[model samples]
Target chain A: MNRFGFFILFIIIIFSSKKLYSKNIKVCSTCEFKSLEMAIESSCNYDSIIVEKGIYKEFNIIISKPLTIFGKGTPTIDGNYRGEIFEITSENVTIEGFNIINVGESFKNDNAAIRIKNSKNVTIKNNFFENIFFGIYLEKSSFCKIYNNSVTGKATEELYSGNGIHLWHCKNILIENNIIKNVRDGIYLEFSNQCNVINNISQNNLRYGLHFMFSNDDTYRKNNFQNNGSGVAVMFSRNIEMLDNVFQENWGSASYGLLIKEINDSKITNNVFLKNTLGVNMEGSNRISFKGNDFIKNGWAIRVRGASYSNSIVKNNFINNTFDISYNGNINKNLLHKNYWSKYNGYDINKDGIGDLPHRPVSLFSYVVNKSPGAILLIRSLFALILDFSERAYPIFTPTYLIDNEPSINKSE
Target chain B: MIKILSYCFYDITRGYWISIYLSFYLFLGFGLLFLNNDISSAIITLMNIVIYLVPFISLIFGLTYYYSSREFTELLLVQPLKRKTIVLGQFLGVSICLSLSLVFGLSIPFFLVGAYNIENIFDLFVLIVLGCFLTFIFTSISYIISIMNDNKIRGLGYSILIWLFLSVIYDGFLMSFLIYFEQYPLEKISLAFVLLNPIDLARTLMILNLDISALLGYTGALYKIYFGTFNGIIVSSIILFIWLLAPVILMLRIFKKKDF
Candidate 1:
C-alpha cells in the first residue's frame, strides 16, 4: 500500500474503534454499580449511564467526560440544600430526564440546579427543577439547548432568588418550551447573543418575566408572560426581534407589560399587553418598530419618556386604556399613525375609514400626572375631564406635534 | 312613606318624559354596546352619559316635578301628615323613581347581553350605585332650589345653572386654580376639591372601582391608598351619603318655615 492509502486506513480504524469501545452503563439499586458517582468514575469518554428511578442524595457531581447520562425514569437528584448539583465542564454532555431539587442558595456563591461552564453542544432536556436558587445557569457556554424543562422556584424577594434559565456570555442557545415561574426572572440573558427563546410560559415571577440586558440579535417569540412583577424588560439591547408575546395582568405602581429602555433597532410586533400599569414604558429607546400590538385597559398604554427618538408606533390598537400615549418631553421624534384609539371622537368625513381630524393622545391630565403623580387622585373628575377636553380643543400643555394624523375610525381588531 | 312612594313611582313611570328618558338610556346602552361590541368600552361610554347627562336630566326633572306637583304638595301639607314626612316622602319618591328608571334602562340591556357574570357584575353594580347616588344628590339639590324660589321659571333657571356649574363650570374653575398654582403640591387640595363636588366625588368613586387608578399614576397611588382599601370605600360612601342628605335636610327646614 502507498503512504496516503495507509493514512486514510489508519483514520478510519481510529474512528471505528472509538465507536466500538463506547458502552452503556446501568446504575440501579439491584445492579453492581449502584451509584451515579461510581458509574461516572469507572466510565470512559462517550459512555452512556442509565440511572433508574430513585432518590440520589448527592451534590457537586462534576461531569468532565463527554458522556450521555440518561435516567430510565425521572430520578430525583436531591442536593439536600447543600450546594450545587450537576456542574458540567465537558463538551458533548447530555443530561436528560432528571428531577433536580433543593439547590442550596448562597450569597457568596451562585448555586444552581445545573451549572454549565465552558461547555459546548450540551443538551439538558426534560428536566424538572424545584426550590433552586438558579436553575440551569449557563456561563460562557455555546451551542447549548435547554428544552422542555419546568423550573419552579419559591422566590420571595429579588435579592435572595436567582433567575430560572440564567445565561451569561452564552451564544447560539435554544431555550424552548419551558415553564418557569416564581423566580426572580423567568429567563435572564446578559451579554448573550444569537439565542432563540420560543414558546415559553413565564408567569408569577417575583421580578421580571423575561429580562434582557446588553444582549443583541436575539429572537423571542410566542412567549406568555402573565402576572409578573414587571413583565419583560429589554434594556441596553439592540437588533432584537420580540414577536407574538402575550404580556398580561402585570399591574403595579411601577410595573410595565414591556419595559424597553435604551434598546435600539428592535422589532416588537404582534404582542398583546393587557391590563398593565403601563403597556410599554420606554425610555431612551430609538429606531424601533412597535406595530400590530394591542394595548388594552392599561393605565398608560405607551408612556414614552424623554430622549426616545425616531421610533415608529403604527397600526396598534389602544382599547379602553386610561390614556393612549403619554410623553414627558416636547421634542416629538416618534411617528404615531393609523392606530385605533377607542377615545378618538373625530369623524370620518372623507369615507376613507380614517378620521379627518387628528387624535391627540397625550392628555393634559396625563401630563400633569407625569409631573406630579399625586394629581392622579383627580382622575376622571369633572375637572380632569374638562382639562383633557380643553387641551384637546386647544393644543396647549400637550405636545402639539405628537398627534396621530391617520387615526382609525373603527377599533382595530 | 311607602304609599306615597308607590303613588309617586307610578305617576313618574307614567309620565311621557320619563318614558322618553328610559328609551333614550336603553337606546344609548344598546347602541354603544353594539357599536363597541365590548363590555368595557360600553361601560366607558355609559360612564360619560351618567356623569354628564344623568345629573342634568335629574336636576331638570326633579325641579319640574316639584313645581308641577305644587298643588299636590299643598294638598299633602294640609293633611294630617307632618311637613317633614311629606317632604321626605316626596323626595324619596322622586329619587327612587329616577334611580329605578336609570337602573332598569341601563341594566336591562346589560342583563340581556349576559354581562352579569362574575367579572363585570361588580362594575355593573357600581354603575347602578353611582346612578342612584347622582339621582339622590341632584334631586335633593333641585328640591332645595324649587323650595327656595317660589317662581317656577327662576327655580328652573337656578336648577339648570346648578347642574351646569357642577357638571362643567366648577371643573373649569378647579382646572384654572390647579393651573394657577401648578408650583405647589396639590394632592391634598385636589382631593379636597374632589370631595366638595358631588359629581367629582362620584366620578372618583367610579374611576377607583374601574381599576383605572393605575393610570392616575402617582395621584392614583395616593387615591389607591385611600380609595383602593375598604376603609376608603366607606369614607367616600359616607361623603356621598352626606351629599345626599345635606340638601334634603335644608329643603325640609326651608319647607317648614315657608309662607306658602
Candidate 2:
C-alpha cells in the first residue's frame, strides 16, 4: 500500500509540473519580460506569450521553440526596413494577430515578413503585413496553414518586388481567406505539391496574381484575381484543379486572364473570365478539361498557340468576345463541344435545343489574324466577311476538323 | 427645295419597293433578335447586313429611281427651278427616305425587346448614324453616275461596279497589300486605306464603338490610340461628314454641266 501511494504521488507531481511549465508569459513595457526576445529567451517549450499593443523594432526574430505567440491588440513588429521580421524553424508553432511590416529589400536575399523554413504544422493567422519584400514565405515546410492574412506592398517594378505568399518546396499547405495585392505575384508556388489555395483575393500585383511553376497536384478554388499585370500563369504544372475563380479586368497588350503553358491533366471549371484582353492563352497544354466557364466581353476568349492536344472544352459560354477562339496551327487536335457561342448563326429546326449544323468556332479571319496581326485592321471588312464565308462553304484555310459538332442551340443558364 | 423634297418623299414612301425594303429590314431585325435572344449579337448580325446590304440596296434603288424619274426631271427642267435645287432636292429626298426606313425598321425590334435600356445607347446610335451615312454616300455616288451616263444600262452597270469596288475589291486589295508588305509598318497606310473606303470607314466607326478594336491586335492598338479617344471620334465623324458632302457636291457639279 505505501509503495502504491508513492507511485500515485509521483505521477501527480509530474502532471502538475507539466502544467506549471506551460505557463503564459506577458511581454510589455512594464512587465518583467519587457522585450519579446527576452521573453522568448526565458520561456520554456509550449509556453504562451501574450504581447501587448506596442511597437517592437526588431529584425531577424528567429523562433525555434514550439510555442504560441498571441498579440493582444495587434502589436506592430517593425523590421525597420532592415531584414526579415520573423524566421520560424520549429514545428507546431502558432503566431497570431500581429502587424508585421518593413521587410528589407535585397537582390540576393528573399527577406520576408514571416519566413517559415524546414518547419511543420505551423499556423500563421490573422496577421497584417505591409511594405513587405516577401510575405509569409515558406521554404521546405509541410502541413502549414496560412489563414486570414492581409499582405499589401508597393510593387512598381518586377525586378525589385517579391511575391505576397510564396511557397517553395512545400507540401500539404492550406492557404485560405487571404487578401494579397501590389506584390510581384500574389500567391506563388514553386515546386510545391498538394497545396490547397482557397477563397483568396489577389489583385493589382506587378506580375501574375497567382503563379505556379513546376507545382503539381494543387487545387485553388473561389479565388478572385483582378487587374494584375499579365494575370495568372500556370507553367510546367500537372493535375491542377482551378474552379469558380473570377479572373477580371486584366487588360494589356499581351495580358491574359489565365496563361497556361505546358500544363497537363488540369480541370478548369465554372470560372468567369471577364473583360480581359485574352481569357485563356494556352500553349502546349494537353488533356485539360474546361467546362462551364463563362468568357464574357474579352478580346479573345481562347488563343491556342503551340501544339495543344486532346484538350476538351465543353459546356462553356463564349459571349460577346471579339474572337471566340484563335488557333495558330493547322493541325486540329483539341475537342470543342457543346459550347454556346454568341456568334453562332445555325438553326434548330427540330427544336431539340441543339443546332442542326455544326458550329465552326475558328473563323478564317482568325487564322489570318494569327498569321499576320496587321490584317486585324481589316476585321469586319467585306474581304474578311467573304473570306470567312468562303472558308465556311469550302472548308479550306481554317482547320476543317476544328468544329463544334454539338453546339448548344441556346445560351447555357 | 423643301417642297420638292416633300413631294419626292411622298412619292418614294408610297412606292412598293420602298415598302419592300422597309419590310425586309424589319423582318431581318426582328428575326435576328428573336433568334439570338441577345442585344449584342443581334447588333453584330445587323451590322453585317447594314454594311453589305445597305449600300447594295441604296445603289440599285438610287440608280433606278434616277433613271425612272428622268421624265419628271425633264419636266422640272422646263420650269423656273434651278438644276442645283432640283438635284439636291431629289438627293435629300431619297437619302432621308431610305435612312428613315432603316432607322424605323431596326429600332422597332429593339424597342419591343427593351434593348434601349439594356444596351449601350451610343452603340445603337452609332449604327443608325453609319447606316444613314452609307445611304447618303451611295445614293449621291449613284446620282453622279446616272447624270454622267444617259444610258440606263451603263449607269446601272457603273453604279454596281462602284458599289462592288468600294465594298469588296478595295478591301481585297488592301488585305493583299498588307499581307505582301507584312514586314513594313502599315498602320498609317492601313488607316488611310480604311478612310478611303466609306464602307470600311462606317465599319471601323462601329467597331470603335463596340470596343473590340483590341481584337484587331497590333493595328487595333494603333487604331485605339487614334480612334479610341474623344478627339478620334470627332475627327472620324468629320471625315464621314466630308465623305457625305464630297459626293453630293461632285454630283451637283456634274449635274450642272450635263447636257440633258
Top-scoring candidate (lDDT): 2
What lDDT, from 0 to 1, does candidate 1 have? 0.87
- Model 1: residues >4 Å from true position, as ranges? A1-19, A314-320, A337-359, A382-397, A404-413, B1-3, B29-37, B179-184
Give the per-residue lDDT of model 1 (tens digit) for A223-333: 999999999999999999999999999987778899999999999999999989889999998999989899988888998898898999999999878878878776557
Cα RMSD of all models vs. native, in order, equals 3.8, 5.1
For B1-260, candidate 2 gives per-residue lDDT tens digits of 99889989999998999989899988998898778766765787788889888898889888999999999999999999999999999999999999999999888877777755434566778899899989999999889988988899998898889888988899889888988898998898899888888898988888766745556655677787788788887988899999999999999999999887
TM-score of each model's chain B: 0.95, 0.97
lDDT of 2 by residue, A1-413 (tens): 69999999999999899787799999988989888888888888899999999988989988999989999999999999999988999998999999999999987888999999999999999999999999999999999999999999989999989999999999999999999999999999999999999999999998999999999999999999999986789999999999999999898766789999999999999999998989999999999999999999888999998879889999999998878998877544688999999888889999998999999988888887887788887777778878988887777777777889989987776
Best by DockQ: 1
Compared with the true structure, all predictions reach lDDT values of 0.87, 0.90
Proportion of native contacts in model 2? 0.59
